[model samples]
Target: MENFNPDFLEEENDDLYEHFTFTVGKGQSPLRIDKYVMGKIENATRNKIQTAAKNGGILVNDVPVKSNYKVRPLDIIRVLFTHPPHENLLVGEDIPLDVVYEDDEVLVVNKPAGMVVHPGHGNYSGTLINAIIYRFDNLPNNSSDRPGLVHRIDKDTSGLLVIAKTEHAMSHLSMQFAEKTSEREYVALVWGNVETDEGTVEGNIGRHPKNRLQNTVFLDDEADKGKPAVTHYKVLERFGYVTLVSCKLETGRTHQIRVHMKHIGHTLFNDERYGGDAILKGTTFTKYKQFVENCFKVLPRQALHAKTLGFKHPKTGEFMRFNSEIPEDMQQCIEKWRNYSKYQELEE
Candidate 1:
């Protein structure tokens, strides 16, 4: 939670790379700010915290402070740091894009599954950024310096994405996301029949203590361990072994939907990264097992789609919403489940 959020658009897309605020306990003893930070946050290095202080990334009661600053009781501490540079070497590539809507300030594209939003790490090319930069010019760069992207969706998730063509548009679009005024709806096929027709999942999401590759839910006493995240789900359809659900995001923590869905005991169908790929549900009948496996082959990735996206027009202040068709894989998988459910009910 790689760069962006909205489950988090991966973490690279999170609004800020790092922003932490903590209150010193009443009984807390005096300690160096850097050292205190290292203790409170996992994987934080002394050198890093010191560097952050040097960069004025550390604050005490709204004032920038040095690493040597002594923490006292009731002190308000804030830490801010951007993630390491990414999309730095992005170059325009002549990749085709499914552009849905475009204007002087904004562009909406229906991004297909398997396409990275921007370049980073192993994926240095063939991203939506590469494609858009090829077609468009002088697109605005956000605080992270990635041009045109205001938000992002996962590589395996198919759906609509809005692009900012001007700096004014960028700021406006980003503000909407941060303020939760924008609307995003995702459809997912998850294991288990969710008991409630609609429900809200309120939990703090943070990186797993042991599994750095995944996010976990922390609640109640441990809520502060992670970032606050909220997901609202409504049952769309039900299969004997799985359920199709529509999820709305209130906060875009990294892997928010994936982690929250898993936490509620209904991991997304075929979400391998979150342990939804295996046969988490279904029966022991050899025929049924084979049927499920065939469905998996039909839809090899997580059964999630960014079906609807709505946001205010950055320049005109007009609210706009875009809808996209489910990808072939997910649609086929859902149909298979529909038939399977129909036959299973007849047998019962």
Candidate 2:
């Protein structure tokens, strides 16, 4: 690797790019090369980063390294981002979106379940970001092409989302989310009956110690501690074993609803990561248990959904609210509960 100024790496580009170099920071050792690069680069997808590493785009101390190579202290890392293939990159598909409202400054859409917000990891195309890119000609040229994304819901979580069309709108909307002035609500069918009607779970959430793919609550104070998160939930209906609850997020954290509910002993139905299996076992209805197990075979992700979003419009200064009905899979879960009640009556 030549003596390239790191400052040149920050230059804006509308075309292909070359290799960029960065140094491994202290206490940042023992991370996979791809994972390390993902943390270092803003808005770069993991798959793209990994692809670059595999093709000799990433080098350590002037020697090419694999994606899985672990980093040591003071390692010189270089990443070359080759322009992605035209088909693999995010492009506007002519997919019809349920646009709830649209204006010059902002747009609101009822984001469907199973649509990822942005390209990442295994998902590189057919995302909401791609759709927005297709719909609008001039997108904000920020770190990512997703200019107006104020916040995001999980891929399998369906709900209302606001997109800012202008840079000013994006800035104000992002500020609202940071200040916790925006209202976000979700409806989830959690395993196990919530003993309390309404309660708040306050904790710090960070990456899980053992599981690299999941987040966990950290109770103790640490140097690089997790951010403070609070969630208030109220049980809407109880099915003797499982319960339908409405969750209000005061602080947005990754997997906030799913993890916080689990931390309080009621994990979401069919959530594979936390304590979902225990709920399947505790239900009195054996048939229902078998049904849930079978459903898990088909439903690979968690059964949590974002149902409502409320925020003040950045440009118009008007309060905006949007709501979406639960998706079919979640509705099926509720139907199973109803059938469980019928089965119990027949048994009696």
Candidate 3:
């Protein structure tokens, strides 16, 4: 961990600034107060908003409110940003960090499975951001509390991720990711043997109407209303009944790999949102069917791991790469599949 100057503002002077007003919308009802204010206020961080609400800067129908206060339809929410300039926005906690590489300008961390990248609903602390705040006094201001985070990995996905330490580094890295110049590769354990060695999945991803938490692929007509997503996959290993694959992203969307894999009839193992469970059940191999069911019960999340990351160093303008091995649980699942395959061969 390295110490850096804190960038959060500490105090506000009424003589120096003016107040702005924003109204809450119906779509924002039931959302956390901190999140609601963050959405309405430009350049305001969640931490700042939370602090303001705690100090009575937030008013709902002319009443001071709390950060966790849930909004109701047509609620009139007002925020008065009158806080002093503070340099330290987040407190550093001694949360564990799997450091792959570290430099003055950036850090590459091997994020463990089941760790959320940043704070959100039901998770305000113990996140990668919190750990980074502890390690580095502060991150660049491009993203408020998030500091140097340029991209994100799913909470259940283990892999390599990079963070920028300075504003210049954050901007440079973000541009690379936006331009698709950064190479991100993921290793996944899919439910069935891929019929081909390589393939591409291109489609639009949008929220599921029936299931709000899930994303679905749509066509050109439907895609107009959806976000573009693209994934390129190559088979890495074949186990007769299951396949190990590596996928690269051309475009990143929510659950792009899981959704695209499912669209092609080869969902990642243990993926609850997609069709992985259903596909496993349809396998003709009785041994694989039983293995998948048993493994599914024990595995906590989908078998997707980000194994490699490649991009130019934000500060140096030189190419750099990072890699992380699969987590133990996923590796064990692969080993079990191999052993089961061997046992079935003996029976044959």
| 2 or 3, greater by lDDT | 3
List, residue by residue over 140-259, the lDDT tens digit for candidate 1. Answer: 998777899898888888899999998899999999999999999999999998999999999989767566668899879875577889999999999979999999998878678999
Tell me, by TM-score, which candidate is best. Answer: 1
Please write out the lDDT profile of model 3 over residues 1-348, one tens digit for every residue.
Answer: 033123312333232222345555444438887776665543567887887776666767656678998887677777766532232345566888889999899889999988888765556667888888887765786544367788998888899999888888889998898889999999998977798999999998866645556778988766454578889999988776678899999887978899898888787888776756554634577765677777776666898999999999976789998888888888888887777777767978
- Give all candidates' CA lDDT scores: 0.85, 0.76, 0.76
Of the candidates numbered 1 and 3, which has the greater TM-score value? 1
Q: Write the candidate numbers in order of decreasing TM-score.
A: 1, 2, 3
Runs with alpha carbons beyond 4 Å of true place in candidate 3: 1-91, 143-145, 275-279, 282-290
Backbone clash count for every predicted candidate, in the order shown: 18, 0, 12
lDDT of 2: 0.76
**How are the candidates ranked when ordered by lDDT, highest leading?**
1, 3, 2
Measured with C-alpha atoms, the lDDT of residue 321 in candidate 2 is 83
Model 2 TM: 0.76
Output the better candidate (1/2) by TM-score.
1
Please give the RMSD to the true structure for each candidate, in Å: 8.9, 5.2, 9.3
Candidate 2 per-residue C-alpha lDDT over 1-348 given as tens digits, one digit per residue, 9 for 90 to 100:
355444433442223344357777554549898887776554568888877776666778866678888998789987766665332366776667889888988888888878988777567778888888888977654434455677888887777888888888888888888899999889988877788999999899876756656678878554344678999999888876678899999998988998898888888877766757444545466766676676665455677778888888887789888888887777876777767757766877
TM-scores, one per candidate? 0.77, 0.76, 0.73
Better of 1 and 2 by lDDT: 1
Worst 10 residues of 1 by lDDT: 1-10
